[model samples]
Target: MRLGSLIETKVGLNTRELKKMSNVTYYLKKFADNDLLLGYRPNSSKVSCNDEFVTAGDIVINSTTNEATIVSPLNEGKILTQSSIKIIIRDTQQLDLWYLCYLFNGSQFIKKQIYSLVEGTVLRRITQSNIQDLDIPVISLEEQKRIGESYRIFMVRKRLRIHREEEEQKAIFNFLEKKITYVKKGNKDEY
Candidate 1:
């Protein structure tokens, strides 16, 4: 089945408009080296400038993540730039949202489908139309829900692992900083 039949897709905000916002918050992109971050300005008109605003349950995909993650309310109600694609499922009965996300992000078949449609000279870009036209395998809703649940669990574990590694690195850096300072001050009594 064509993905367009199952969901509504929209392009995000542009970089120029995002920069003008006062208190811009999280922004998703297709090719980001890091997670999207922006400042927000409550009083600024730029906040309401964009026609498309991402809401909770929207599946966002970018080049950096290379996968779709469902938006939590924490990241909700923010305007996205053109660098990412926002997808909203039309009917829960016909298609499972979680299943769609996992398939698009993890399935090699889906990746091939997307790559085949990608167009760019310097940076590869998959347009909204391209994504909408891609083929999606229709599966039983129960099976999709099960697969989606598994994918959600995997993501939780991945995040925990990354957090642990970051903490360990921070500890190592702190220890080295203290040790260097002690040596520089000639305060090492035992050594």
Candidate 2:
């Protein structure tokens, strides 16, 4: 079924919640690589994993509070979720969380609205009021399930490609190391 006719509400039961941080709940600004980031991966503690944020999964976007392009997931930030920065939407069983996430990523319908509502001199943002007014397209539970499954497949393919690239790089490095070793031995025959 079409979303406009499904139940009645902007957000379905599936909601977005920031995993870290406290305060500044409800509506928040999400940051990513100018794209939709999905999946749940642990942040790297070696350097700065918190700053490596994405606009995917259970996330609450907070455009206000602080203006930091890179927020540490391990530290306190405006976009981080705590007890206050959370919004719960009651879905009509016809919808699911994965579908909602995909819809959010689409951004075709809401991007313009968000840009129009966000107010700032240098940094643009979408306020909570904007989120409330936004409308989400609803579909049948089966459709939602299909969409969710497709998303999972896409993620797996992307990860596999990344892994392959890393392996190729490692092979190249190993080959170079062997060549260097051969050269040091004055074996000029090493190609």
Candidate 3:
């Protein structure tokens, strides 16, 4: 099935418009590391040429992530700017959200199709039409649900592992800091 038939695409707000808003409103900016991790930053005072915006259940493909990632916007006004395309599934029943995300992020065939649309030498970009025009396999509702559920579980485990690693790193750093401080204090008399 044609991807366009299964999903709707929207262009997000540009950086220029986002910068005009109150800095308190967090916005997703492209080419930033935080943005790749589904993180948002305060709108910058500088103007931007890129335009993008995202709401709940929006799948964004951009240079930052270099792949598709689902986004759950915290507020209605949160905007995505720069090299991002927001994709919304037309019908959850027809195409499972998690399944679609998995396809974009994991399926080699689908990834090849998506990357085939890339254009430009220095800064490759995928056009919205290219995304819409791609073909998607039509799976049974039951199968889609099963795949979607599995994908969700995988994502949960992945996040948990990352959190655990970060905690371990912090603990190791704190331990080393305390030991260094104790040794420094002990040698103070020698100095």
Candidate ranking (TM-score, best to worst): 1, 3, 2
Compared to the true structure, candidate 1 yields what TM-score? 0.76
Per-residue C-alpha lDDT of model 3 across residues 71-188, encoded as one tens digit per residue: 5445434566655677766666687666776777778878788777777777777777878887888889789868866876777666667889999999999998877887787754
Candidate 3 regions with alpha-carbon error over 4 angstroms: 19-26, 29-53, 63-66, 73-76, 187-191
Deviation in Å, model 2, residue 177 alpha carbon? 2.6
Q: How many clashing pairs per prediction, in order?
A: 10, 13, 6
| Candidate No. with top lDDT | 1
List RMSD in Å for every model shown. 6.6, 10.3, 7.3
- Measured with C-alpha atoms, the lDDT of residue 134 in candidate 1 is 87
111, model 3: CA deviation in Å? Answer: 1.1
Per-residue lDDT over 1-191 for candidate 1, one digit per residue giving the tens place of the 0 to 100 score: 99998877777767776777776665654212122211111221111223466665566777433467665556666777777777766777777666887787778989999888888867777788887888988889999978877776676667677779999999999998988888889886653
* Model 1 steric clash total: 10
Give the whole-model CA lDDT for all candidates, comma-separated. Answer: 0.67, 0.44, 0.63
